[model samples]
Target: MGLLKNLDPLLTADVLHILRSMGHGDKLLICDCNFPAAEVSTKTTTKKHVIITTSLPPVIDAICSVLPLDYFVEDRVQYMIPDAGLELPPSSVDVKNLFTAAIKKHSDTSLSGVERTSFYKESRKCFAVIQTMERRPYANLILQKGVVGPDGNDLKP
Candidate 1:
């Protein structure tokens, strides 16, 4: 066991596995509560659930405690469904507010959204996909792993 690493026994095996596989520049997704995180996280090399929000903010908090999601590369806009016929969840104002607050509290890090397909692709690459069990809409977020600074701090983009 190391000295400074966060230790929590309740962590799922798949989540731990995903965290183990992650390195700088890798990605991890804390998907919305409705996303199929459990099923999907099993396929990844590393993943974990921080258990932050029922909708969005808590997810951010859980993630920030361990992950420094800086150095992310995403379009500075929210990702949307491609087809007009696609269905959407009921609206909740928490999506952006919680998301922004979560990242901000962690560091100078910021968030950006990508298309649904793109976000899905990112989730696949993520070490783990954490589902929040939130009942809110548009609560999904993808995180990118960034290098720790020379002082061994998380890098912010």
Candidate 2:
């Protein structure tokens, strides 16, 4: 607790270290309980699968509290979409809303959709994957880290 004031308590020391160590442009994957987190994490930059015993919304809120969303990319946030091109699942929509609220102050960036297979491929390249206890289907997303200016705000071009 040493002087850290507004961050969510759910963000453990390990989680905070991971978030802090990530460089701008690195990706962080947040996935639901059903995801193959252990397997996919093996390929990530950190090769770590962090399991946080909480739901997605709070986790997103906690992560976004300190992690800036990329401004250099059109879609710094990405979610899994059904391969068949069906309507976005309810959980996915909920995740989108959560991300929207979390990043509203830092960026005007929008969330994009990646098909299931492609999403898996992208997840492998992330800095790390945080698995939440969210049971809802398609409650998975990737957040690209962005730069912070000297004054502690997002750095835009």
Candidate 3:
């Protein structure tokens, strides 16, 4: 059996490679089942992007375990807001809390909710989007990559 350093087996080699290749300030979109991940990812014509379809919470846990949150930015995590008149679904709330708990384990930060259109526009520029099978409305999240110090237990501010 091969042993990994920080990530687990659920985070595949391709995803790990993508995570390692990303630089500070780069963004990664962790989308829910309702998201149009394929369509949005294909819109990015400048750089090649990868789309991994998996469960949201596990992927979120794995990514947060290794990837540092951008402490320099005001909001390192961005979530999608439900359309006007549409109530925030219970699933969405659950997903938000799940992500918050995971991120809090690594950094002292909260999730920021953005307009749906704006979130979609931002998704176009992300390094990759991991589409989750989570059947939650508005559960999408965007994480900004942060730099880690030489000692590894660091988040550059």
Which prediction has the highest lDDT against the true structure? Answer: 2
* Model 3 per-residue lDDT tens digits across residues 1-157: 4767755766777678777888898888888877887887776532444455665777788888888878889878998986566678786788778777877777777788888888898889887777777776787888999889788954764
Candidate 1: where are CA atoms >4 Å away?
1-21, 46-55, 72-90
Question: Residue 9: error of model 2 in Å?
Answer: 0.4
Collision count of model 1: 11
User: How close is each model in CA RMSD to the real structure?
Assistant: 4.9, 2.0, 2.2
lDDT of 2 by residue, 1-157 (tens): 5646776787989899899999999999999999999999999999988999988878887887788878888878998888875777776677767756766644676778888989999999999999999887788899999999888977777
lDDT of 3 at 88: 83
Lowest summed-lDDT stretch of 10 residues in model 1? 75-84
Pairs with steric clashes in candidate 3: none
Q: What is the C-alpha lDDT profile of model 1 across 1-157, one tens digit per residue? A: 3333474332445555565567876767666667777766766665454443355566566556666444554432233233345555446454666667767776675456465666666566666666766666666766766666777777544
In Å, residue 121's CA in model 3 sits off its true spot by 1.2
Model with the higher lDDT, candidate 2 or 3: 2
